[model samples]
Target: MKQKRFGIDIDGTVTCPTSLIPFINKDFSLNITLDDIKKYDLSEALDIPAERCQDWFNEREPDIYWSSPLAEGAKDVLLKWKEQFQLFFISARRSHLLDLTQKWFETKDILYDRIELIGSHDKIKAAKQHKVDIFFEDKHDNAVSIHEELRIPVLLFNTPYNQDPVPSGVIRVDNWAQAEQWVKAWIDSESFIQQ
Candidate 1:
């Protein structure tokens, strides 16, 4: 089988979706559970002004990223797929944090083919530039846009915030285990189609 280039997102996809909840609750002094986060932008759910939210995020971004716990099964499955797939991490994080990102990966002992931090959630261009055949994402709009713009399948990790309608190409995965199974199925189906 040919090696496939895969696009993966960080933050809520690689890291547990609720990883930042504790920080938010303590910092804002508001008791909100992960279930209360219905929007990817916390400002919308928290009823905080966008500017204030952005300012707070800017100040606490590094700490949030550094302290996030990995999503269940993310490391093991990614490790197993490392040799078979070109694993590219494409995040909305600022590129300046490349050192931190790399350090975290090193600390986790994970391997990757490439890591791109574009400082924006709009990743269709980056995905196209990388020529990725498949994408793993957690943002609803990002997943939809990437799937529509690139015409490639996207495995959107299911989270409370991203429970939106998706087209046929956008597959929802509850965890990395389901992600692995979906990728295997997709590859098998694609192979059959090509033949």
Candidate 2:
């Protein structure tokens, strides 16, 4: 049987949702938490001009990604799944960040079968090209669109910024632990069906 592939987003999914909070708070000199991020736009959350926020992010993107922390329980679950599934990480990060991203993964002691830096939020093309059985993401629109377009299950890691309602195929999970539970059950069902 062919190995099932898992398409996962890198940042804000495997990495803690609050990973960028420190940078934002320090650079902008504001006291904010993850709860302050009610939307995906950092500018909107910080009440700053979008252009200024974008400039700041562009300048500090590398440092931000390099210093990101892994989400709790993500390492264990991902490592365990590494034995059973193809871990295909699909990220919105630019292609130039490949080296940095790989180094970051190594620094975190995480393993991946493949990593695709698509530089855009629209991941439908890459996901379809890779033929992933399921997807994991923290972006609300990305999760909903991927599931709806691909007709596959998508686990949306719940966060303050992505509180939007998801479609039926988009399963909202609180953390990596909950995500693993859902994936395990799904895998078992798939095995039974294949058998």
* Candidate 1, backbone clash total: 0
**Superposed model 2: Cα runs more than 4 Å off:** none
lDDT of 2 by residue, 1-195 (tens): 689999999999999989899998899998989998999988887789999999999999999999999999999999999998999999999999999999999999899999999999999999999999999999999999999999999999988989988889999999999999999899889889999
Score every model by TM-score.
Answer: 0.97, 0.98
Q: Report the backbone clash tally of model 2.
A: 0
Which candidate leads in TM-score?
2
- Model 1: pairs clashing at backbone N, Cα or C within 3 Å: none
Question: What's model 2's overall lDDT?
Answer: 0.94
In terms of lDDT, the best-performing candidate is 2
Q: Write the per-residue lDDT of candidate 1 for residues 1-195, one digit (tens) a residue.
A: 678999999999889998889889999998888889999888998999999998999999899989989999999999999978998999999999999999999898889999999999999889999999999999999999999999999999988899989999999989999999998888889899989
Clashing residue pairs in all predictions, respectively, total 0, 0
